[model samples]
Target: MFKHAHFKAHTALFLQATGLTGGPGAAPLFSGLDLQIPTGLTAVTGDEGTGKTSLLRLLSGDLSAHSGTRPATDALWLNLALPEHDEATPEQVWSALQQQCPRWSTELQQDVTEALSLQVHLGKKLFMLSTGSRRKVGLVALLASGATLTCLDQPYVSLDQGSIQVVRGFLNDMADHPTRAWLVADYEADPDLDWSSCITLG
Candidate 1:
């Protein structure tokens, strides 16, 4: 868990998207969409084909918009269940991320690692870990990255109940953070969370 005093204080919009529209085909998943994302927790909820992941990708600059404006910003979108480094051990991945993320927090990483019971698997290659464990690895990176805008796609997919609770507890602590934004895309918003905003798609 993060101490409230560890967070920096800043008042600024994390991201803004206007007239956004893009998808796999000629028919876009969503059109003329606008969003004003601010610091704190936000939820993107929708059914299977409702473009939840697509919106996150567009916002994170992982996918180009068909017609809209989303200014560049420091952001991260890591698919928790399937990271790219299949051959690297969690320890290696953590070390690489620490070098890459200018604001990475070693304390948060250690806390999350222990909270998720990930210490035992750090030396094993990612491919050797179970799906839930792999997701836990991604969770550690995501939380510790300390990016201004952190996007999580279906974060709870393969997590066990205890791990799920841990993730939720972390998010709960982050809900009122003053300088960072966390956008969670899932089927429905967790009723227990105090979301700063909730965007529901078709």
Candidate 2:
């Protein structure tokens, strides 16, 4: 049996009519929408151009809401939409991070890298890495970080079937430990996703 979690104690993710595009008369993505996030997985599913990614960005505070409330976030943002820097090698990226704020445990880094099967081309430059590899590296890095909330945008885009399953498992693990709240934006729903809540935009 899965352990019960205290939803009240978990950090909340709020969403209110978040606007994506900018400029005069820039229309809001989904206006007057309210989402109260507590725990477990919450999927923002919709058709293409329905502003699902914008919702994730708003939740992560990368994009600001136009005229409504957004849940308070105490975590860092991870942009899956942004590609890795072209000039940095994966190893160089890791090395650079070590010189800054993060000092990831060597064992955890190795485990995460292997879990994503990224050991094969640690020497490869970011510009040459496949789309899937970039996603894996960023997602895995977020998974290994200290952030308590994860907002992933169209995470299934280039993921293999096995990799998708791994991500699902990782989400489950995060919830089981009550470590973070996952806000996943995807086109289709996975059967195994035990969502505590789901927010949809039409």
- Work out the TM-score per prediction: 0.87, 0.76
lDDT of each: 0.82, 0.63
| Clashes per candidate (backbone, < 3 Å) | 0, 1
Q: What lDDT score goes with residue 164 in model 2?
A: 82
Error of 2 at 179 (Å): 5.3
CA deviation > 4 Å runs, candidate 1? 1-13, 24-27, 80-84
Model 2: lDDT equals 0.63
lDDT of 1 by residue, 1-202 (tens): 1011112244346677888888757888768887878778888888888788888888888777899888877788776344468888987888887787899999999999999999999889999999889988988998999888899988888888999999999998998888789989998889887677777777
> TM-score of the candidate numbered 1?
0.87
The local distance difference test score of model 1 is: 0.82
Per-residue lDDT of 6-40 in model 2, one digit per residue for the tens?
23344354332232332123676556554566656
Clashing residue pairs in candidate 2 are 14-71
- Give lDDT: candidate 1, residue 94: 82
